[model samples]
Target chain A: MAIAKICGTETEYGLRMLPPGDHNPVSISSLLVSSYVDEVQRQIDWDFEDESPGNDARGFSLESAMAPAVEAHLLNAVLANGSRYYVDHAHPELSTPECTDALELVRYDKAGEAILRRSMDAARRVLHEGASIVVYKNNSDGKGNSYGCHENYLMARSVPFAQIVHHVVPHFVSRQIFTGAGKIGSEARWWDRAEQAPHFQISQRADFFEEIVGLETTLKRPIVNTRDEPHADPQRYRRLHVIVGDANLSEVSTYLKVASTAIVLAMIEDGFFGEMDLTVENPVQAMHDVSADLELAKSFRLVSGRTVTALGIQWELLQLAKKYAAERGLDCVGGEERGSDALARWERTLELLEQDPSSLSRQLDWVAKLELLEAYRDRTGASWQDRRLAMLDLQYHDLRPERSLFARLDMERLTSDEDVDRAVREPPRGTRAWFRGTCLSRWPTQIVSANWDSLVFDVGSDPLRRVPMMDPLKGTADQVGALVAQAATPAELLRLLSE
Target chain B: MMPERELKKRSSASRQDEGDVAASAGAPPEAATAARQGERIKADLDDLLDEIDEVLEDNAEEFIRGYVQKGGE
Candidate 1:
């Protein structure tokens, strides 16, 4: 069912050149990404032969919706951890290796933060005097522009795309109550003259969305991205690349964001949600409105003309998820036990938000940020528009523990430091990442390039041998671990694979 | 809204970055207002440039070239 809910996260970290100046983000991003690849792991090229970002799921791409180019000359590398650390659109983007479960995704996501931290140090050694890369696990530049932290979930090809769009839009619109990373002031150009001018928003990425559905990511960003490029067996799976989430610093927030969404997707595929019409009239506007409403009392017009607050909608979804678990089971998200844990956590979080949003200061990003900002505002006697408050908001996302405002706060953590550290060097054993990471680690010199579904090896042959891994469920540690252990060289591995 | 007493009581215990608070606190009201005004202007310019970037990104061939030219590739 849904191929083990195979999921991954891609975060384009917000970066600034310290001793801030008019530095080219593209060059600095390239340097930062390359420093990690050059210093930390074996560098392998990303094969773009199968990439077709222009292919829209709706059978026709918008004429204006240009697909992201596969730039072969860029500083792209497949790490020994099976993750891709590369620069995309002048941002240092770290895409976690395919994960079999949500919790594993958290560990890998935390590992990505560590890798970025290490990248900063490595880049420091090479950067110009008095210049350094300060990375933030944030979505916005605080200048009306926002980056992305996209999540990928592998779903069965049998499920209709229209159903996915209909079910997910409400969750995407309402989930910000917990998933939000918090933002200072509204940057939405359209919301500039709204009746309720928000002093702060629940989510950093919510204000930047311009469409409910589309293929473009940088411009006219959609809540449910329509890019249908599945890096696996196309007939068997479709990777739902979600670009609507924030780059969360709170571990609990990250965990819940992935887990809850996975559970909802599972529920959708299992037909547990019977005629659930949670559609908002304008999803783009609703996302901003939900985030801006501090009281969590503002309601959006549903398709039925019924109004529901973000919290109310989430509560309904949670109840359905609970019933879904009771009936079919939650094996899609690790196991029934893990699924129950996600549900319990979701219920508790919603309860807290309902009772008092501030009660979740330690459990959620938006609450913690709100508490910190309010505290700062009271102490300094500053207004919400104060530049210091804005700076404080940005500092909350800083990656450095010594300087990070979020790190100082008593936020609840789900993953251990050891797990995060280990995840930086190793891949999750249950996915194809194990095969990809093992090859890169064992024979760094032999492997020429790698991607999600395959690897190309030189193996001393006149023609490079391309090993096809069309299935995400195959080539896992169980399937290839013994074979990998037995092979001594790339040539031997190639020969073994041929067999 | 937090009670004034509650805000004062908790803020001192919760506030760790004294230097940051002081930095923002040190700015004079007039200077801060002027700076905020400047930021608004700059934000307006940034919005315009981003719109231009969006237009460039809409075209397939031009977007690819721009991607490389902007050091994206």
Candidate 2:
């Protein structure tokens, strides 16, 4: 039996206050996250030291022994649990420890819920707390935007990186159907030929701009990850860092989202699914395509020259899942109605693929994608030119307000040099602190500050922190290929300054 | 060929095992005395078992004869 380990944490939602007399419900919810963080932190000082032997005073402890005083201090606070409330970038994020099983994962995810409820209660206790909070479970706003929904998987480094991505991407794309937090509206369809909607059945972003960088807000991208670090153990393991998923309100959906992926990954490692043949024609487009689809019928050709549609792969995996369920004596899949619906959808998608692969193929085109976007908008009765939509479009795309038309037209064309220079010289709107912030920002600041040369963060460190920035204009055909060349670990790269 | 007396003894021992199980199951509760008085079921069961065993022993020669006939057929 393959052991499954799923460890994930979500930030306490950030709040953005609406102007006086604005009746938008979402804005009210946003205000709650903003005001709640300060009140919660005032009640508990997460930076308090624990006095345990051989333990750093500032470091966190699994058990509250080192700082008995701090433990006693926490009881006086609103949150009875010793969970810390800290500033994650600009957002208040409550992180739960890595859990070993699905039930434990549920417990950790629920911890966020408890934190939110308590914060709301605390707010009610205080006078002049007028703001409401809306928690978003999305990665980006619709219209090619991006946000963070980070995933951290402890993987054995012995597995090759290429193999991990190959087996994982298709499932990552398809999993959104079950796990997608529903979205409200869409953008104007760019193409006039097709009647497809611009808005999606599942929108990654409900709100446009998020000041924070964490998973608790929204599901914008199918996966937002930085493939920078790899563990050095000879019996290698890679902690897969994933940041793209909606903050799930439904416990069952959250369980299925995390557990099913863990199982699929286990199957991949176990060679139960055989091998994923989809060599994504364009990795970035494939990612965006997966995010846009609602029915999960999108098909990509396998490396074997055969096409295994997402529906096909899911059906085969479900068969194996049935055996797993039986062996584990789990009734998780017991609901006949849901099982029937899943089966029906699975069959319907298979039929669609067999009847018309062109329907899916057309979706691959930029024009068709725009049509889908428009179709969704029409269905939702949303205007494409709405300012909220525009801001959402920019935010979801992670496009800077000042980005040139050329950069907007081709993100792959933007090189490390241009990105670095822009980040250093002009920096995007509200991003001046990316250079100084202790918390990680949405953009890779460590690489950007290094410029194209070997970046060095500190001079005295034994290993110098360096990153190779690829010249986007002159680099290879791969979009990220032109960015930065891989350098020594941050520690090694930092040591070069002293030399 | 004459069967060993030990086989007969083993059969009798298995019968005693069944009797032990039935005895250890305990008598009906006082609440069911009315139903138990009318049933007299254990006596009937014991009589049926004796009849069954007698029937088997009496038909043993004929049973062997039928087996040989079936083989011939």
Fnat of all models, as shown: 0.10, 0.00
Residues A1-499 of candidate 1 have per-residue lDDT tens digits of 5547989999888776766456788888899998888887767888888877777888775655444453567689998888998888778889999998888999999999999999999999988787788888888766666678899999988889989999999999999988998988876787547555688889888877889998878877889999998999888889999999988888888888999999889877776778878888888888888888889999889988899899989998998988888887878788977788888998988987897787677778898788777766655687887666666777788786555767655567888889999999898998899999989999998888898999999988689999988887778899989999999998898888779
RMSD of 1: 10.9
Model 1 stretches astray by more than 4 angstroms: A61-70, A192-195, B1-73
- The lowest-lDDT stretch of 10 consecutive residues in candidate 2 chain A is A430-439
Q: How well does each candidate superpose onto the true structure, as a TM-score?
A: 0.86, 0.44
After superposition on all CA atoms, how large is the RMSD of candidate 2? 28.7
What C-alpha lDDT, on a 0 to 100 scale, does residue A286 get in candidate 2? 44
DockQ of 2: 0.00
Candidate 2 docks at the CAPRI level of incorrect
Worst 10 residues of 2 chain B by lDDT: B64-73
